[model samples]
Target chain A: MPTYLTQHQNRFLEELLDWLRIPSVSADPKFHGDVLRAADFIKDRLLEAGATLVELCPTAGNPIVYGEYMAGPDRPTVLVYGHYDVQPADPYELWTSPPFEPVIKNEKIYARGACDDKGQVYMHVKALEMMLRDGGLGAPCNIKFMFEGEEEIGSDNLGIFVKANKEKLQADVILISDTGILANDVPSIEVGLRGLSYHEVEVTGPNRDLHSGLYGGAVMNPINALCDMISSLHDENRHITIPGFYDNVADLGPAERAELAQAPFSAEAFTQSIGLPAAVGEAGYTTPERTSIRPTLDVNGIWGGYTGEGAKTVIASKAYAKISMR
Target chain B: MPTYLTQHQNRFLEELLDWLRIPSVSADPKFHGDVLRAADFIKDRLLEAGATLVELCPTAGNPIVYGEYMAGPDRPTVLVYGHYDVQPADPYELWTSPPFEPVIKNEKIYARGACDDKGQVYMHVKALEMMLRDGGLGAPCNIKFMFEGEEEIGSDNLGIFVKANKEKLQADVILISDTGILANDVPSIEVGLRGLSYHEVEVTGPNRDLHSGLYGGAVMNPINALCDMISSLHDENRHITIPGFYDNVADLGPAERAELAQAPFSAEAFTQSIGLPAAVGEAGYTTPERTSIRPTLDVNGIWGGYTGEGAKTVIASKAYAKISMR
Candidate 1:
């Protein structure tokens, strides 16, 4: 496109890889120093990009790298938000290559936070540098960068920081590059994302565990009771049976539904990819609509009584399940 | 009621308590010597009772203490059966006194296996002693005693022993003293006992666990599917839904049902005993009927996914339940 970007493409990637090697995993306390160092990496890059004000704002958890460049008083402000931290690379053996060691293969970067937010955040930093240093058309509007180090962990401190620095973050528009495109060719933009609510449910049958042979028919089994309760949450048609569960859920019109259905999808391929026999959901929705438009209640975990080795005939006193709605 | 029994009652109790202190737990291999010692106790007591033939019948597991007294050929031969081995005493802190150290409290002996079989088998030994040593009425018929040492376990060796010693175990009639009387005042006999069939059921959804946000409603969750399948096993009336489940179940007549209803029972007491809101079972059946006559299907245990301390939003690859029908 431009001579500056074409000449510095390899340098931009090398810089991104250097930042990725920091292993800023906020979930683990062992990466505390690395998380702070990653924040510093963002601070230096922002300063090098000719930002006038760059500060590593300290929060209860991790630091938030805030940087700003004012093109003019009349120009509209654009706030670019992203994160520097990545989720914990657990079950480490599952990866083909080391997670923190970023490597490129087949024109794709393989790393834990390569495409999540670190790579996207680096793109904005490099774009600002290209426009400022290329001796060409510079930034047309005021630019603000707010990169936090706790997005992978729940962003608990980010909420407090945003509230405390509301004036500093004021902008005409906000652009978050945290999500993904539908496909390379499609270049889709997600209009909305679902919110999450998690709950832990428990069922109590008897005060104490009892021998199944002595008390099977006479007393209630907690596991059975829990299963019954979970089953009743969904009706025969797979629609949730909770009263008023769908009362506030908005229904998409025919045109909107038809437009969503046009997104690239293959039912057979989807099922084959996940190693499932078929895709199943609510009665009246397509696969795409079921995942995007409709709310779903699912049991994330369930347990009671003897689940170890060999058989043990017991009617457990209590049963529990972790439920989540999206 | 006899003079001999009245005079030797205290001694008989003391002898039984001594045998109970052996801690013959067959389920645990750590008690191997104790189990063998308990078998020797039965053998010595049988010999002291003036048995004409006594032998320790060795099997793959613990030995069987066999003893016999031939009163007369014309008289009917009777074989008495019992066991010396007891179930493991675990969570031992729950016991009022040490399980191995027998104690007499409030006129009742407290010890593992004090009443299970060792107590009852000792009664037969003392009865034979009374009839032969007291010189009153003497032996009315030829008697044989078969006391085993692996009843607490699966009795795997007992099966092989019985098959090999068919001629030695032959008798006109057999009296097993292993069961219990309903109540001290209202003594009752059990004509039949229910059989058990156990099954472990599993439901597989995808090949691997999935993220709830990425694939919530689009794919079937194994835990939800398992819950649905388990819930469907019982209908609204609490009757089993398996085909031909009750095809051969014999229905008792009104007279038999009325006779069974005459047993002393209190619904409030039964519910209070187990700390349940109420006794629940198949409709149209009494509490006793549900426990005794009517067959039942119950989930002994159920488990899947993260059953740990906190919440994990996972659609597990597999869900499992241990089900049993009686």
Candidate 2:
């Protein structure tokens, strides 16, 4: 029979709810205190979960929560990675409920970090607790927990930490619970990872926003100039226009591509799932190929001049955009 | 003598305030009624400005307000382009006053349409009124007013209207006052217009948001993958890495480049103006060069799974971004 929910499980979930209530957003410096509090909270939980030598490791930015559960020197070691920090909840009104207030709705917990690293990180802690109760030992592998508070911001210090403490963090393979499954009911394993590139561009025409009436014919509108530049990045086929962008791209073999395609995917189902007219991707590739193997460029955000209240007839002094590539 | 700013000027501003109060945001369909009201208000204003033939040209989308003030056949025809619609006043709370309230603080009117086409459009109407009252019946230019209600939403119909009514809209030059000046005091002129390209990219990995714990090692995190891809687009010097991005770029000559560089711009002043640590851009170019002649990329907006309230340890099934270029 499956183990039923116990009083301990209820208590564990309550603690998680408490942790979710703190807005430990590391991306915005305004949440600096909250991040520290969250770090302390995690450290306390680590101690409660029977982890020895729990410490809040400081970094140039946010701190890292480090802990260990040693069975014996003879056991193999396993390092677990996770982030406790989160992105800022802006355009905040879109949320059905407050971001920091943990709310369980329709069997799914609806909060900023519910399905993100926080909830996943908690699962590992709970699993560890279950193991401790069953037998005062973790898995056959000795476990080390490294939870950084700046993963959402970018694990800036993690590289240094990993390099400096290679011996301390050594393990056979790293176990991280920071990704997700294909669906709510279906389980999946990710076999490959894609790389990323990000950039911000600013376009300026006049030294400042100009009067369109007096200068419309003579002065360049940065926003219009920016739009033209962005539009040219992709051809009608949606391939990135960067000359040598695809030079380093590795093509998937037919067999490997077929294997990936074998994964259950329906164009109709995918469209319905996302509420889109149809699946859109590189002109010649299947949905899976477009997503998993193909490179893509996207504009993450853009603004210039006055994107404000009513119309401002002023040609904006500058236009700005953030781009991402994968 | 310049016929400007009589006691009637204050009253005309007051009337414009009344018209500006309507929140005619075209991007959101929910503001359909508001948009209609704004159109009617513009029609009324045109009629008041002695336009003989005023019509609201309906299209598949928003209606266009068309008016004619033909002084005589001998006079040069001037087509005035303006928009009655406004952008969505989101992040709405950021406003010091209500977007549509038309609050006059200092000498500037504070409202969504204050400096935008509305205020500028009003200037033309008032100018016409001054001309008419002063018995300048046969004005220097025959005016045709084309006030669109969808310029904020890309002027989807204006392009069609311009194409369809090429003969009717023909003019010596299009006069638009929908832009602003370099500063509050400095007079400036715009000499060029940039083109635009806008696109959205959806990067998919697994079929659904996954539990990072179980799938972190094997499955790819679209967010991580996205970041990596974005990071790869630019080299250390901030040059775009897309292979042939600069193939079609028209390089400015040294004299022209030097002239642009000599334009009154200070790195420190620019940095302080935008509140940044320092300016960063493409190396070996002046700030003006980077913003003007050079092509650039930016992520206009980005979102993936769990950009919500709290931390969600979700390896998002997909990540999305909106990009624009110039």
Index of the highest-lDDT prediction:
1
Question: Which candidate number maximizes TM-score?
Answer: 1
Interface RMSD over true interface Cα atoms for each candidate: 3.4, 9.8
Please, what are the lDDT tens digits per residue for candidate 1 over residues A1-326? 89888998888889999998988887678888999999999999999988889999999889999999899989999999999997666546657899999889999999978987899999998888877885747999999999999776567788899999999999999988887565466676778866667778989888777766567788778888899999999997789999999998999999999999888877887789789889999998998888888999999888887665435566888899989887
Question: lDDT for model 1, on a 0 to 1 scale?
Answer: 0.84
Q: Write the per-residue lDDT of candidate 1 for residues B1-326, one digit (tens) a residue.
A: 98978888888877888899998887677888999999998899989888989999899889999999998889899999899998666546556789989988888888888777788898899989998876557899999999998765556788798889899888998888766444466666666656667778899889877767668999999999999999999998888899999988889999999998998777787788789889888999988888788989888778887665444567888889988788
lDDT for each residue of candidate 2 in A36-75, tens digit (9 for 90 to 100): 9988988898887778778888887788899888878998
Identify the runs in model 2 with alpha carbons over 4 angstroms from their true place: A1-5, A134-139, B1-326
Residues B1-326, candidate 2: write the lDDT tens digits. Answer: 34444646767877899878988888677888999998898888888777878899898888888888888888888888888887666545557898988788778888877766688887877776666665444457788888888876556677898798888788877888875455656565556654444456667777655434333323344544554565566665667788887788888898988877666656676556544445566778766566667776554444555433223334466765544444
Output the worst ten-in-a-row residue range by lDDT, candidate 2 chain A: A211-220
DockQ (C-alpha based) per candidate is 0.39, 0.06
Restricting to chain A, the TM-score for each candidate equals 0.80, 0.92
Give RMSD to native, each candidate: 6.6, 10.5
TM-score of each: 0.73, 0.57
